[model samples]
Target: MAGGAIAVAAVGVGWLLWPSPSGRTLPPARARVYTEFSACLLSDSSGVSGKAAAPVWAGMQEASATTAGKVSFLAVAGPESESNARLYLNALVARRCDLILAAGTAEVAAVRARAPALGSTTFVVVGTGSSAGNLTVLPVAPPAGVSAAIRDVVVAASERTSPH
Candidate 1:
């Protein structure tokens, strides 16, 4: 009986002191590259029309030009409606864009629906109230100063999450 007790006590202590499985350790995540190899910009005509579209397109052009590699911009020219927005988004995905900049809630929602299959692409939404699976939101307000504010916010956020 004494030997049996000793054996039980030894088994209990061994179990208590056992190390956790090394395989359970999480692998480090890969570093994300913010640089764009190819990009597509999609916006509703109502959100970006007439004089308003010119400045928005100009801003995008300037930003793309500043990047290290060449960037292409494709404006989804069609009727300003939710259905058209979805079509534009689908076309953007078909183009195999590395990054997509969509403007407005409907467009963002459309992009979100396709994000599961389009996981490799990054979507940046401006002035939108919708969320995508892997989409990054960068809200921009009008008149001029807001662009600078959004730029600063994006830079700060990128720096915080970027792998050193």
Candidate 2:
């Protein structure tokens, strides 16, 4: 948890399902409920080899259990590339993930660029700063360590994705 910086990208579905008035008689809003959600973690080369990887991965598992969500990790084989990061993120979107955690600067940029187009998915950028459409950039300091930061991001993403 003491190595390179980490970022996150997530897809949030709760807001989309929440009934907003389009000036039509939408059906009565029922309480939103989520038995489970799917989360995707995108990591670049630095993240895979960094000391923080194991702890961050473990934290994702723990977060999954705590939030009742299924988590998947994708470690891109090559070094960081914005285009590649976008490709990976698009792949996760195709899988219909509710939340995405992108763990690097490149990944964060990719998520930021693509987030607006993916309406239902909530993108959480861990180490970056910005609030673009559905993308939530968490500028969390790493003083508590990368794993803890990742844990918090995942937990928040899961909560946001959940139906309330």
Q: What local distance difference test score does each model get?
A: 0.57, 0.71
lDDT of 2 by residue, 28-147 (tens): 887533356787777776554554345566677777767877888777667578898888888898998887877776777788788888888877766646677778766655534556
lDDT by residue (114-150, candidate 1, tens digit) is: 6667777677665545655767765556735434433
Q: What residue runs in model 2 are displaced by over 4 Å at the alpha carbon?
A: 1-35, 46-56, 143-146, 159-164
TM-scores for every predicted model: 0.53, 0.64
Q: Judged by lDDT against the true structure, how good is candidate 2?
A: 0.71
Q: Which ten residues in a row have the lowest lDDT in candidate 1?
A: 149-158
Error of 2 at 26 (Å): 52
> Tell me, what's the RMSD of every candidate?
16.4, 20.3
Q: What shift in Å separates residue 131 of candidate 1 from its native position after superposition?
A: 6.0
